[model samples]
Target chain A: MREFFERLGLMAEKAVVTTGQIIIMLFQAVYYLFLPPFKFRNMFKQMEFVGVRSLFVVVLTGSFTGMVLAMQGYNALKRFGAESLVGPTVALSMARELGPVLTGLMVTGRAGSAMATELGTMRVTEQIDALYTMAINPVKYLVTPRIVAGVLMLPVLAIITDFVGVLGGYFVGVKLLGINPGVYIGRTIDFVSVNDIFYGLTKSAVFGLIITLISSFQGYHASGGAEGVGRAATSAVVLSCVLILVSDYFLTSIMF
Target chain B: MVKLSAEAKVGIFVLIGIILLAYMSLRVGGMRFGKEEGYTLTVKLDNAAGLDRDASVKVAGVEVGRIKDIKLQDHKAVVVLRIKPGVRIGRDFTAALKTSGLLGEKYLELIPGSPNAPYLEEGEEITRVRAYADVDKLIADLSEVAVDIKKVTGSMAKVLGGEAGAASLSNIVSNLEEITYNINAVVEQNDERLSTVLANLEVFSDSIKEVAAGLNVLIKENRDDFTAGVTNLKAAMETLNSMAPEIKHTVSSIQRIARRIDEGQGTIGKLINDDTTHEKLNRTLTGINSFIDKTQRFRLYVGYRGEYLFDADDTKSYLSLRIQPKADKYYLIDIVDDPRGNRRTTKTEVTEGGSTRTVETTKTSDEIKFSAQIAKRFGDLALRGGIIESTGGLGADYYMFKDRLKLTLEAFDFHKDRNPRLKAGAFMYLNKYFFITAGYDDFISDVGLESAYVGVGLEFEDDDLKYLFSSVPPISF
Candidate 1:
């Protein structure tokens, strides 16, 4: 029992330290945002990496998520003689909850891992130290562009997700389930408000910040050799995913 | 394809995303473009519980605009509705909160007032607002009803719970029984008086029969005297021929009197010669003439029927006259020869040699019974009431199949000593004048007054009778 408590305390201590580092790293990224040599080129490149490359996967995930939601919603609402409600059900779920969340997880798995791996490799191979020796600010040069790109592009990706998701729900609800097309669209528009879409976009923007900052922090502080770089990349993806979900709950509670 | 730079690819991706976002916001989410289109109106509602900001405003089920805002004022909901252009509303328009489906979103519905009504300006408050039917209030009312029902049941359980309640119920039953017994005793006490009234009715019917018999006797006795008077009238006709010259002198005097009246020389002359009074007298005579003409045009039918009663083994005959003034109204008179005579029974107790024996005597009278009735017809059914077979009665006849078939029912002779006589029959018309009828009479009685009867009848209008007489061949001497 004593050993278990001691291990638990240690785990708690590690969690607090990591949380503090993430917060400080977020502040530094924000501080570097207005600094000199604004890297528009690098930001574009990171945007393409985070948003453009992840488009196909986001579309695929969003469509099937909406399709499945329609199928399940039809089955449930049909029991109450309300099969027409499936359109609003799928739309509300995608706009208010699933669209941003799935995009965050998907981008975290793809770009977040890449961010952590590249920075971890630079850190371990003495490239970041070399930058420090050459009188260059490493945090401003490396982390700022990725964070800016993430903050800008994730919402864009989420908007696409929401668009494709509604289309998928429309296809399934109207074509496959035999619901009237006009009624499907009317019910969807009736229930889903602009604030609901904005709610998802806002959550996605926060998730983007979380993903890029945590991954960058993990990579910048990476130790040991090549194995440590791999570890950092893996931890970045896992941590980014967990934080995205965790912060989503807080965001939803506050906004809604 | 040209190899685009990463920045160009990212820019294209972001541009598409922005376009999609714009479509979602404007088209799907119903977001206005820069400036909101349409004018806003204010309305006060009793309850706007499910209605939200941005809810649709519909006119005739077509979406015209949306709700801009909602606020509470003086314990009422004040809603701001933005109405689209080209949809003009009047000040008398009614605003109501309506739900789309059973568990769906609420929308504001603007019911347009009359076309001639004055147009309502923007930002004007709509005074006519209808309260929505709320599901929560309905459920709350249902719960209150359930509580009242529970309270009622609880009180009922307290009042009728045990042996005391059972005893009270028995007491009520005994009281009802005693009341019925007292009514029976009262009826028994009036039994003799009821018999006396029935005996008086029998005497009245006998007097009517005696009057008819006496008239027959008086006619027979006056036959020879009537012949002697006819001979005396012939001699008087010859004397009138001798007085023709004297009659002419009297006729001249009457003509002189008429000449004086024509000169307007007396009271009778003024009455006859005054133009207004003459015109009034002429109009009154014409009115009376028209009324008589109308009555003369009324239809008259004479009919004969004979019914064979199976149980009584007797044939009853009727000579009937029917006078019809309008298509739906008629008077009927029938002289019936009923073989099953009117019966009067008398009972008396005789005590002889210390033993009392009751003797029952029955007297039967064979007399002509008459029926006079008035009937009014409505569509295929005719109702009649007056006197049926010498008794006050009611009857109905249902005609079907272009009046080819008739179902008839009658009830009469409601005596205290017996059940009312009920007769039901069907008449099948063979042609305009001939019909066959079958029926049960006095079926409500169990003392063997009931009989099954079949009859054949012939009916003819006055015109038909005249045509029959005209068609007959002349006899040669």
Candidate 2:
């Protein structure tokens, strides 16, 4: 029982230390963001990698998600003689909740892991120390551009998701389910608003900051060579997805 | 197309995302670019529970505006409406919150009250608002009704539960059946008689229809005669209508005379009501009867004469009635309208400015004058001595040519300061009832009051007078 207690204490201590490290790294990245010697090129590159590259997968997921939502909504609302509500159901879901959350998870899996792997390889191969010896601040050079890209690009990606999702819902509701075209479009416009889309984008922005910061934190202190790099990548992807989902609920509760 | 660099690709992607967001905001979300093109009005609703901001405002099922905002004031919903620029909301309009479907979004509906009502200006309140019916309240009321129904149904079940109740119901049914059976039997017994009566009625109705058709044909054939008769009747009615007032005046005068006699107000009334006056009138009538016995053979000639005077340039008229008691003896009475009038001279003493003097003035009055005369004829020569034109006078008439022509001379007023008036005239009779006369009046008067006159006269004897009186229109009393 003592050993068990000791083990629990040690795990708790490690969790606290990791949480503290992540917070400190976030502060450093934000501080460097405002400092001079800005890196527009790196930001553009990261934006391309995170937002542009992920467009295909985001569109695919978003559209299918909306189509399924319309089918299910039609089935349920049909019982109540309200099949026309399917358009609004799909639109509101994508704008207020699904659009930002799904994009965040997708980008985390695709770009967050890559970022962690690249930083982890640098930490393990002593390149980070070499940068320190050359009086270079590694966090500013490596993490700031990524955080900037994420803060900027995640909302852009969410906007694309929301647009495609609404289109897919319109196609499925009007063409497949045979809802009145005017009613479908009219109801969607009546129910959805810019504020709802902005809510999702706001959440995406928070999620973007989370994805980059946690990934950088996990990979920046990596010690083992190949195995640690792999572990860091996995942890970055896993932690980002979990944080994105959990934070989404809290944000929705507060903002809405 | 040129191969796009990574940075260019990223810029394009960001731009696309922004453009899409903007499109959604403007098109789908209905966000405006500049100032909204509308006027705003306020409406207060009683239970706008399901209404939302930005809800459509429709007029007769067509959208013309939007609900810009909703506010809670004094526990009521006050909605601010943004209406399209050209759409007018009359002052007499009702705003109602209505749902599209059973569970749809709430919208504000504007129902205009009158077409010609003046429009409501900007920032005006739409005071006529319809109270929204809440679904929950309706459901609650329905539940209450359902509870009452359940109680009623429970009572019904209790009342009809037992064997006794069932027996009573069966008894009622049996009684109804017995009544219906009796009624059916009665109807069956009388069925033939009822049909016979119905047939008779049908025949009677057909005969009546034939009679009516005959009447219609008769009326159509006599339409022109009917119109002519109607026109004649209308003309007669108009004549009577015009004479109504004159007839009423005559009747009223007769009534007044009768009432005066009844009230003992006039000579006739005194003679009837007073014993002494009655005795005196009876004695006088008895004495007059002796004279009337001789006058019982009396013949009356009523005549009128009109004359024009050359010097005066005016006309005189006389209505005369002559009574012939005998073949040679007659009395004449005349009512005359004289243009010369009656003349009187007076002297008045005046004391003005300490001097006494007398003023002589002559007065002339245009009063109607009367003449009563008696005449006696022998051998076509007549002599008259009586009042002539309101003065005592003597006159002689000489007949010529079998009495078809006559010559007359008169003198009167000898007491006046002027020479006694003398008049002469020649009369020519065209028939037994009509005569023309030319005369010189007051020719001997030194006051130069002489004038030559030409006159015509009509006389109706007793038989002719009776016919004339009978022809006059009758006046009802």
Candidate 3:
């Protein structure tokens, strides 16, 4: 029992230290945000990397997500003779919750894992150390642009996701299931509001910030060999996903 | 599989991204582009259920605008509506929150008021607003009415069913029985009066029986006188019976005489049966029938006319016939028995012997005279001008009630030295085929023919006139 308690204590200590390190790293990244060249070249590169490149996967996920939502909403609302509500149901889910959440996850898998792996490889090869010796602020040079790009592009990606998701729902509801087009679009406009989309974009921005901070933090702290880099990349993706889901709940409650 | 960099095509990809974001912001996020800014109006609503930003604003049940924003101010919802240009909203317009479809999503409903009201300017708040009714209150009121109906139905059931209904029905039956029993008691109380009436009736019947017995005894005593009278009647009948043969002979002779009459053998028989007499009678009948036929075409008015001569101081009477063919045309003929006749009279006084002697002279002799007129009717008035009593005259008639009543005026006996005699009379039917007439004749002429007279006359329809008018047989082709 004493050994078990000791091991638990060690685990708790590690959790606290990890949390503090994450907070301090986030502050440092924010602090470096204003101190240097704005890094538009790097920021645009990351934006293309995060937002443009991830579009295919995000769209695929969004379409399937919306079709499933339509099918499920049709089945449920039809019980109350409200099958016409399927469009608004799909729209509200995508604009307010699913669009941001799914885009964040897909992009995290595509860009965030790539960010961790690449940075981890650079760390293992002593490139980041060499940057530090050459009087370069690595966080500003590497992390700020990535964080800015994530924040900038997640909303763009979410907007695309919302559009494709609603299209997919329309396909399933109106074409496949014979719902009236007027009822589908009318109910969507009647139920969905701008605030829903705005708050969803807000959640995507937060998710982007989170995915960047955690992925870059894991990459910055890499110590082991090539195997350790893989672990860091995996942990970054897992942590980013977990944080996204957790923050989505709190954001949804606040916005609602 | 391959690497694409932002150094090439990044601008285009980013541009596309921005464009898509703007599309989503304007289309999916329900925002508007800056180039198409429209007019805006605000509304303060009491209760705005299911209202959200970017909801549609409708006018006359069609979408004309969108909700720009919604906020709570002082516990009331303040909504800004962005309306497209060229769509006018009156100041007295009203806004309400209504479901788009039954039990579906809700939207803001705007009522464009009459054009006479002021136009709604941009950013102006509307005053007329209707909030969603509280469904719970409506249901509560409905339930109250239902409870009242239930109470009424329950009372009806109580009256129609169960022990209370039975008790009331029995009570009504008992009251009826009691009323019948009271009537029986009242009949019993009048027993004495009823018996007295019965006894008086019995005594009167006994007196009548006594009178009938006395009459029977008187009849027995008069039996002998009745038999003697019957015997006398029998003797007279015997005398008649004995003369039957002579009477039979006389009847045979009369039969011969009747046969002779039928054969045109005697003067009286010839008078009845001769073809010459028959021909004469037929000619007379045809002439009379033709006159009757002419009369049948007319509605006849018979009037008694009297005239008083001022100089002669004598009254004359005449019977006049007015024949009306249609309501509008008539002919008048009068037979006058003039006492002073058509004469003009004069009296002169001469003082030859110191005593004045009056000498009367007549300018014309008394004569039987007549008047004739032809009238043409125009609505209620008719114009008549013709010879009247051997002189030219003019007259008028006013008809009433389909000519059942009339007032007539005849100006006749016109003279240069004297005014024309004007006769006015009112004629009315006392009954069908009978009339009474009253008139003053010569009211205007001072020399003669001025008199008032009233008389009733029979308007006779010749008995043969009916056959003459109706005897046209059915024409054969």
Candidate 4:
């Protein structure tokens, strides 16, 4: 039991330190966003990787989620003679909640782990120390463009997801279920207000910042060999998902 | 020429990323920042069901515009609709709130009324518009009505009972007893009367057969007589036709007399038409009353013996009597007689062997009595039992009723298998001579079998027959 207590103490200490590091990293990312000498090329490359390249997976998840929601909602509402409401129900749920959160989780899995692993590898190999010795600022070089790309591209990805999701609902609700095409589209538009889409985009931007800062903090502090890089990658993905869910609730509550 | 700064690379990436992000946002979000490309029309709705900022507006299933914005103003929903600029809408166009599908969406559907009407200017309101009635509320009302129907049917069932309310406690026992008694009585009464009626029917049928046989023999024996009678009738008709001119002249003279009376031309005609004639007739009737009074004041009695008896109660002593008695200066009379009494006393009684049997007996008195009976005559006829009896001959009387152009035919006691007692005839009208008549009678032997007949006739009338014959001589002999 004493040993268990000691282990708990160590875990608590590590958690505190990690939390402080994440807060400091968030501040540094915000500071870099407004600073001069923004890296447009790296930002573009990162944007392409995060936004454009992520399109297929985002669209696939968004559409399948919307279609499944429509199928399930139609079955439920059909019992009450309200199967026609499936289109609007699926659209509102996707735009206000699922679109941003699901895209955040997806990009975290795809790009967040990659960013952490690469940075963690450089840390363990003393390459970050080498940049300092060569009179180079690693934060500006490695972090700024990724932070800019993430903040800019994530909201774009969320928008794409929202559009594709609504279309997916339209297909299932109208073409498959024989719901009137006009009614499906009109209900979707009427049910999902502009505020809902804007809120999701804002959530996505915050989630993107969280994902980058958390993954970079873990990677920059990584010690040990390849195993530490793997651990950092895994922890970054898991932590990004957790922060996204927690922040979504708070954001939704406030916005609504 | 060798080195590029890290900041430059980062700057380029950031700039490109921003541009791509902006472009993507504009494309995916469908954000159009410039001016709208259509004439705008605004419609207000209480509820805009599932309409959005960029929702398509359709007309007759054709996409023509988009919904620009939806807002609530003064507790009423207002939807700003933007139509394509080149599309011209007439002023008389009607806008109806329509649904995409059952639950899909709601949009304004414009139905153009008249093409010749003036076009609606841009940004003008469509004053005439209709909202969609909520189908959900209608369904709810139907369900409520169904519930009421169920309740009413349940109450009706209770009121009607299981056997349609036929049973009442008071009648149950008494009705059953009465029904049994009536059935037994009817069965016994039918048994008694059935045989008697059958026996009587058999006798009646035998008599009918005998009568039919006799009728057949009579008809066969008189066959030639019937033919000769028909021939005699034809000869009589020819002779009557030879005398028709004189008859026609007499008919014309009578018609002229009737016409003069109708026109109040002669003295009798004036009596029929003038009030003074009526007054004079009334005075003459009053004078006859005074003469009858004077005659009644003379009392008298007369008697005469009669050999014949008019009734079985009359005896051999017969007399004819007429008596009048005076009472307070007026005369009154009474008469009584038995004429058959005298005839009965004088006749001999005969038996079946044609031998007379007589016994000496005193003769009863028989009397013949006479009394005055006064009756007034109207025109040339007297009415009795709703039939007219004329002082003139039957022919003239017939003519007076049905003129000379009219023929009175009576088919009396005519026997046919279908109609034994049939009577049918036609009377032709004068001038136009179109006569309509109908007859219906039962067959004597066939019981209920009967025959009906209808007849039409023609006649001609002329005042100057000689002149008419001279003007149009016969074309064929």
Expressed as tens digits, the lDDT of each residue in B1-477 for candidate 2 is 998787999999999999998888886657344578889999988777777877899999998988898999999888999999999999999998899987778899999998999999999999998766586878988999999999999999888879988998899999999999999999899999989999999999999999999999999999889999999999999999999999999999999999999998977897888898778878999978865564455567899988899998988899998877677888888998988876665779999999999997878776588889999999888998899878898889999999999999988767656588898999999999999999998898676679999999988887565344334546100
What C-alpha lDDT does candidate 2 achieve relative to the native structure?
Answer: 0.88
Tell me the tens digit of each residue's lDDT in model 3 across B1-477: 556557454566556657766665666444353565679999998777677776778887888888888889999989988998888889888888888666756688887778799788888988899766668658988999999999999999978688888899899999999999999998899999989999999999999999999998998999999899999999999999999999999999999999999987879987997678889989999988976665566565665645444444666677777666566787778887877566676778978878999886878665778788898989899998888887898888898998899898887776776677788988887776677777776788666445676656656544453344335444110
**Top candidate (DockQ):** 2
Error of 2 at B105 (Å): 1.5
* Model 2: colliding residue pairs: none
Model 3, DockQ value?
0.24
Relative to the true structure, candidate 2 reaches a TM of 0.56
How far residue A113's Cα lies from its native spot in candidate 1, in Å, is 0.9
Which ranges in model 4 have alpha carbons more than 4 Å from their true place? A1-17, A32-107, A125-138, A152-207, A224-227, A245-256, B1-33, B40-57, B66-80, B136-477
The parts of candidate 3 lying over 4 Å away from their true place are: A1-5, A37-45, A79-83, B1-4, B28-60, B64-98, B106-135, B146-173, B180-477
Docking class of 4: incorrect
lDDT of 3 at B188: 100
After best superposition, candidate 2 residue B20: deviation in angstroms? 1.4
Better of 1 and 2 by DockQ: 2
Cα error, residue B337 of model 2, in Å, equals 72
lDDT against true structure, model 3 = 0.82
Task: Output the lDDT of residue B307, model 1.
Answer: 90
> How accurate locally is residue B103 in candidate 2, as Cα lDDT from 0 to 100?
75
